[model samples]
Target: MSIFPLDHRPDSSQISEFFQEVRCAAMEFVFPPACMMCRSEMPHRIFRTAGCTLCDDCLGQLDSGHGNACRRCGAPVGPFTIATDHCILCHRENYAFDGVIRMGLYRDSLRVACLMAKNPSGSLMSRTLADLLVDTQYELFSERAFHAVVPVPEHWAKRLIRPHYAAETMARQISARLKVRLATGILAKARWTPKQAKSPPVQRRQQQKDAFHVVGAGVQGQSILLVDDILTTGATADAAARVLKRAGASRVVVAVVAVSPPRA
Candidate 1:
């Protein structure tokens, strides 16, 4: 008699994925695989959970978070430093976000990669970098169970000059990988503000104040993953998270491709 059950029904998603694979195979001969970072031709591509297309050498140059990092700010710390409670650097600082996650410190080749993502032609770079962040921090990311992914919105004035907006690209790509919703409309920059880097320390907080406004009501009791290209002084992320939390978001976790080394 029959050893296999005949009642098994194929899932539609599986069928759709099968078709997608066939299309990818058909396109392979036309466009040979290449590393997204270095643009070197790759003999083969192994799509991991993050769907990365980076060559091994280039991937090695971009340091993943293997070293000890501060639990609060996600900044790399010395081996001898204790970060159980909070990093010594940011312990006294008050941040609106519950925690932070980063791929690595903003230095060396990783620094170069971050800058590349800001260019208008950096869509793939932005997506690949976002995938790298999730690939490096898979375990911690899974535990967060984020309800939505929100990019730190850019003011319209900046968009008029350069419209790439790497943060939004990263957030959209990351949200797809996590099988979660991308909530772009939840938060917005209410007005254009001066660059944080140029602002004085005393004026920095004031500049960020009233900068963001919550536009959607869906964030109530949600856990959000706030995406940004870099984190410096925690001011911008803090400003964004403050509004998210005020909108009834239960938690706001900052995710960045790089964390600028603590200001000297």
Candidate 2:
């Protein structure tokens, strides 16, 4: 009897907190976390922000969209501004998503950052990229009140190969930053398709046709934000948006880390 000290036993919450602190300390020792962008050591203040791995200097270097951009697709238009709402691509091709908010053109440092974030070993960098996206596109996000944030679903085979899908991880970070619900498993890839980067515009659409479908019930009448790593042809976004709309989503907006320039 009385082997245990009943008066001094920690509650479950206290025990959980203690374990969490111990785990964090262990991780810090093992990983010795550094800035994702500049590879500098993360200071204490910067570490307080969840998934923040960018040093202040590197964070300031993020390239956000500038000049005249098409309102519908967020593509940069010519110097002599004409219509702000629609670009030639927007007029020629019909997209399912209502609008797009892109962080920057796919070039230079932004391109390098995107490639790095896609690497399987770059989970921390992926989180940092998400934080960057949130920081740069805060104004765009604040313009709309989305019901949920969903990442463009990766196929099961792809998921097994990489394990941590960059888009999904980025979506999680963005959802947290936006205080929106992160909805997963609602959209699924029906079949694997070849990469769209090299495919012609028409082929890109054909390859992605009926490739995605929606599951579950929460999407009905919800305004959804679909997150993706890149927006090249806009075909993939259109395909996914069609399914979401068919599943009763009132509106779908696309957010991506980078957007390719419109074809000549």
For each candidate in turn, the TM-score is 0.83, 0.81
Q: For model 1, where is the 10-residue window of minimal lDDT?
A: 43-52
User: All candidates' lDDT scores?
Assistant: 0.83, 0.83
Segments of candidate 2 deviating more than 4 angstroms: 1-52, 55-57, 64-68, 78-83
The regions of model 1 sitting more than 4 angstroms off are 1-33, 46-51, 64-66, 80-82, 160-163, 198-201
Report the C-alpha displacement of residue 63, candidate 1, in angstroms. Answer: 2.9
- Predicted model with the maximum TM-score: 1
